[model samples]
Target: MIFSNHVLLRESLHAVLSTELDVTSVGGDDGEALTAAHKIRPDVIVVDLDGPGRHGLRTVRLLVAELPECAVVALTGRHTPHALRQALAAGARGFASREQPPAELVDLIRRVGRGERMIHPGTALATLAAMNNPLSARERDVLRLAARGMPSAAIAAELFLSEGTIRNYLSSVVRKLNCRNRLEAARLAEEAGWI
Candidate 1:
């Protein structure tokens, strides 16, 4: 079963996967899907992570806690490391981008049902690159503020660090990331999923 809030996405997905022998049931909306799953006891449940704010994540957590036998897939449009991390952390066995070819979703669901973790290919790479960067806590805070287009003086004031200390941190961040300029360093940090 696939739980989606969007009527069109739910309807289209239902139409595409209804004939598949592996998919026993498909529905639109979380409440209805959960009800149907309880009634039918399907092997897996695919939920749209893009649903309401923390609702999708909370739903996944609840489902995994309540239905240990059922697997959950997080389907979303955003492939950023933050989103993927949140989904996986919330107990989604699979994460697929809505931008991916529809066929990929079927393959992901099947693979995930068999106990494999599915995520955007680049998501792992970017996440790994981010994890490998090893920025210090202060450096990371400075970089985050810099990425938001904050000036050194403002960062220093906000963080209660000396202006010179903030400048040194920015310089160190640039050197660590091997970027020639502050903007370049910020862009690299953001692209590398550091922020």
Candidate 2:
């Protein structure tokens, strides 16, 4: 099973999977994918994790929660350590970047379908390095709100915190993650599996 939002990538991926002579490509987003899953209950779902519209992490979470037997493999263009962690935390069984060769991707899909967990070798070390760098529960809440691109004042209003307090929390998150900017901090949090 494959769930993707882009036509070109979907077609290309389908072509790659079809070469196996057994794998079928059922591609779409959260709703369509869920419908297909309900009907076919595929053993594995290869999901594209690019672009902004699709909440890849949330999709993976839903799939894992709804279809416990199904395995998810995330395919991404930006295989940052943060995104890697988010996918895994959302119950992804495999993670591969678009930069990887097609042959390796096919192999990963097959392996994941057989109940194996896979990660891009390049990201493995960064992921390991991030293991002990967990954000506190409050920090996680702040970050989640920040992910929506909310301003400090808005986040403060929603979370019932002062603007200065929100800024303090954001600063703390950046320091803890060793990130120079809030964006980088958020990315690290995502990669570290905090989201």
Candidate 3:
């Protein structure tokens, strides 16, 4: 099944896939996709990662949770490393660009339907980079607050800790990230999608 808000894109995919495979299309809306999945029980579902007004991560989460037997492949034009990570975290089994050849799309879907998993190489690198981040969860929380320009006092109040504790967290974050200051550590975490 192909799920997308853009009618023309759905039709285009349907046109291409219909020539060689069975296809069903549902609107990008979450409610409609869930309902169709229940009724149609498609072997594989293709959803647009950048669909209109449809947060692809949430959609993928819902489909994966409600239709665990179905394989989902997110199609997108954005195709950024962070976006791909979001898709994988949401439980999508496959990822493909909208610009991929029709034959490739068909093959990817088929492979995923047969219980294979796929990840873009760039996304794998992003995951590796994320693994290298040495900050603890508390340290990351401090940096996230810092990214919003919060002072130590405010972050302490928000976290229900002392100002000195917040400062300690900030210092830890900076040391772990090997940065000169808290601000630089915060910026690095934010840029890496950690915050």
RMSD (Å) per prediction: 4.0, 4.3, 4.1
Q: TM-scores across all candidates? A: 0.72, 0.68, 0.70
The number of residue pairs in model 3 that clash at the backbone is: 0
Using TM-score as the measure, what is the rank order of every candidate, best first?
1, 3, 2
Models sorted by lDDT, best on top = 3, 2, 1
Q: 47-102 in candidate 2: lDDT tens per residue?
A: 88884476777778888999989999998986667778678989999998878887
Model 3 C-alpha lDDT versus the unseen true structure:
0.84
Error of 2 at 183 (Å): 5.8
The sequence of per-residue lDDT tens digits that candidate 3 reaches over residues 1-195 is 999988999999999998878999888479899999999999999988777886767888999999999999988875555667778889999988888889888888899999999765455566568766677788888788888899889999999999999988888888878999988887777657677
Model 2: residue 83 alpha-carbon error in angstroms = 1.2
User: Where is model 2 more than 4 Å wrong at Cα?
Assistant: 129-195
User: Would you list the C-alpha lDDT of every candidate in the order shown?
Assistant: 0.78, 0.81, 0.84
Best by TM-score: 1
